[model samples]
Target: MTPLAIAEHAPLFIVLNPASGRGEADNARRSIESACAQAGREHHIYQVDRHRRLQPCVQEAVERAKAVQGVVVAAGGDGTINAVAQATLGSGCAFGVLPQGTFNYFSRTHGIPTDTDEAMRVLLNEQPRAVQVGQVNDRVFLVNASLGLYAQLLEDREAYKAQFGRRRWVALWSALLTALRGHRPWYLHLSWHGVQRDIRTKTLFVANNALQLHQVGLPEADAPEQGQLAAIALKPLSTLSMLGLLVSGARGRLGEADSVVSFPFESMTVRPMRGHRRVKVATDGEIGWCAMPLEFRVSPEPLWLVRPAVAPELEATRQ
Candidate 1:
């Protein structure tokens, strides 16, 4: 049951997302191949094209990998990892991450190496660890699931990035500003762990574990643990106050924002009071716009991950 024990018995299945991070899959594949050659380890690589194709690919990979230790390595961004995790959940297949993406939030959280060579080394040398994953409506996400203005911003950023190359921060900032100006509060009805609460919020974030935004202070103790979900709702604020809160959040001092409300829950539902445009949703870094109401929940069991050794140490500390 321990990480060390799991590492000794798992085989590696490297799944690469060819479209991730401006087409870095070829380079990553080379690195992985080189690493496997050097390490003299048995492995297989599966490159995924369309997003919808990930589920079937992962499912088949899981079945194939089950014979050789049941480990699946996601070689793209968080989106690739999320897709693979959804397939491997409860299948006894451990997941690994290569972190070739823009944000690489999951890698940062788990302390995976950023350097390609170093990441490959870690992949060959690391142990299989048990980490928590969030499940919403039978969907699995390893990092966090969120809604509100930020999700809308992600939508804009993704579109802009496709057309404008890598330097698209300006477009993202502009989209964020636009979202702030047009943002409106919506009523959220949530019930969890035998408690019920209502709130009007402009943004809702549900993380699988505490998230430290930009190295700012981490979430509070109320942050959901593995197999639990932590919910944070940003109450509507004046444009000025919201800007201030945004600045504070950027500085990782979100506790200073009076408009922020946070709690831990197992399940919850969010709905708009009146029919409006569909709400945007994001799990990890993938974005989609969905109509209200949205249902979110946590899986009963923890997902297995083949993470760097530092992941357990990082998880032990509350930042």
Candidate 2:
């Protein structure tokens, strides 16, 4: 597909998450406004706070962008990006991002600058490129989705962030605490592309971001680029063993760990062998519950993401 014709005066509808990063939310808002004003671009900023929820704001932005043939931009963390992507994916409206998050796996993977000023420049000048996405049931996740112990870890990390503030150390500490506390292994029935197996695991993590997979030292890190999703399952382990596995992940050797099982798949279904109808799931760092059996697959259509232009050689390779 050709890139959208983003004229200089093209409207930009942005959905901003107030509580996304450690920086003041107002700062991001001002930065966005200042940039657009300097560029002479028409823009709309929708703030999502306690009173103004995310979904409605995203819906409004998507509708407005669709109406004017403008770009719908997500200006926050992965969760905020996921929400906006859910509304814009396959809607024929271009998607853009400003990385106001700690990890920023999605934006960084696509070469969107983390600096607000640089990101605004890219948003204004870049073209739309088709990007892969993952879906668990009806929910879209740009970075990852997981259940069992990994979901619990995300929940605990949020609690810690709420208390100690949002910092990398706080997230790491929460993971350590959660892992040390130990968790029950889930006996699950998993089927993927016609193969079925029963397994016991502490977590089932599905990754759609190559940057994140590569950071964790998974062999399937290139899966997303290859039009596939990577699944990582952790075998039952003692608390000490689990900590050891975490260390290996930190050192980027997770795929070499004995307790880890990693592979790439197009689609998968997971059901609890214990007859539970609901399970806690984490998608792009947001925690929620989903009724089993959970169906995870790569979305059939790619998301039209507005990002920096790829180099000629790399673009040809992607083709």
Candidate 3:
């Protein structure tokens, strides 16, 4: 398929979350409209409201975009991107992002500029490229997924974001508070690489984004680029020990921590050994419950992302 360009005739179906962009949905909408108009691109904007309308909105956009061979764009944070990506998967519609969140990991990693105007321009001028995706059960995650303490930390972070604000410092502070509080270990049975073991852990995190892993100092940061998922498990720890582990992660030396178990794999099965049939899981910062045992793996198909062409040097390294 030809790449979408500024002079292209295909339409763009934009899914915008009003809660994102620091509640400046109007600004995002205007920027999108202005860009599309200047480019003479046909486009449709679907606003995702607070009534939990993201799924239906995205589905509608996906169907429309698919019919016209247009792009389905996500103009929000990670949660919004995940929602749109989930619907666009297998729809044969290229996905675009207009990063409007505290952390734009997916957009930044893929070279989708966080600036709304710049992102819109890229959407109009880029081709769809297949990118790695991680899955937990049936849900697709573009960044990471986890349960146990990490999952709890996500929930706590959201609460903190609501009370304090939605900023990086706020998120970091919330994580510190969550980690400083003692957490109960999760007794889980893990099966991976033809091996099965039972372990007590504070968290079991599976990463699909190499940039995030590298930022957190995990040695298996290259797992995603190698077509595999990276798993990080935290052993049960004292409060101070947990604090130390957090520091290690912040310092990009998490793999060097004794309490950390890091590995790369194509698949892993985790079951609650404590008779719990359901567990809270966080995917791309969204908290939800999934039935045990949880299955984490790389998706068989990639998410067709709309971004700038990869540099020849980077492409060579990937090959």
Candidate 4:
């Protein structure tokens, strides 16, 4: 269907996470409403009060708005977007983003405007486009799924942020430094695009698209468009080497590091060494401690999003 077709039929459901971006939902909602008024599109604002409650809210809202051609707009960061997108999969309800959360990785990758008014204008005026989604076991992720030290850092960062309001990167760095002191190599056995391989590494990331690793002065780019996943493995490095990798990443040359390896895959399964109890896993920026033996796969055509005009041309090229 054409962009105009989708807009004309769908009554937009804007889901705002008030806690995102340090409690900016009230301002975001007003701005969105103003944009809607200007565009003459009907919209309802729903605030997500809790993290796990998002799926049910999205499901119910989509069901209610189904007759009107529902489009669920996530007005927070990647976590909020991931939640709504996961629930709306295969439901024929297009997902839109307002990018109100910190480090909107999904929005940044897709070139969605971070500004509330600009994003709303794009949502009202842009076309709905299909994008691939990644699935690790039962959960859906729009950006990437990460395991190992980085994931642990994410878990810790969230906790620290809640307790102390420290910046996420600073918290992550502190956590990683602490975690690395006790870190051990993990065994990752997997098959990607029918090729079998094994690697023992300290960090493993399976990304739906390439991320401009912060502090690395590299041009930002999407993952390959073959609908395959990109995997990065980092061998255990000395504390100094790890810090150097961060520095190099900031300089945008992670591929140049001998400790980092990246490749493409269609799907894979990851398991930690035996007797490991709680390995960290993160989808988007949300982190959790999970048991070993997690299954991951690339879900073809799992989400439809409204793409802004300024978004990278590659998003428009997706089949």
Ranking 2 against 4 by lDDT, winner:
2
lDDT of each: 0.70, 0.88, 0.85, 0.72
All candidates' TM-scores? Answer: 0.85, 0.95, 0.93, 0.87
State the weakest 10-residue window (summed lDDT) of model 3.
310-319
**Model 3 CA deviation exceeding 4 Å by range:** 1-7, 50-52, 311-319
In model 2, the Cα lDDT at residue 209 comes to: 86
Instruction: Point out the worst 10-residue segment of candidate 2 by lDDT.
Output: 310-319
In model 4, state the lDDT of residue 3.
35
Q: What is the lDDT for 155 in model 4?
A: 73
Q: Candidate 1 on 142-256: residue-level lDDT in tens? A: 7778877767676667777777753437554756565568677677777677777778887787776454532434455334443457777888888878777767766778865
Which candidate leads in lDDT?
2
lDDT, model 4, position 311: 52
**Superposed Cα deviation of residue 19, candidate 2 (Å):** 0.6
Weakest 10 consecutive residues of candidate 1 by summed lDDT: 213-222
RMSD of 3: 3.0
Kindly report which residue pairs in candidate 1 clash with one another. 218-319
lDDT of model 1 at position 300: 69
Superposed Cα deviation of residue 274, candidate 1 (Å): 4.1
| lDDT (Cα, tens digit) per residue for candidate 2, span 83-153 | 89999998888899998887888998888888888889889888888899999999999999999899999
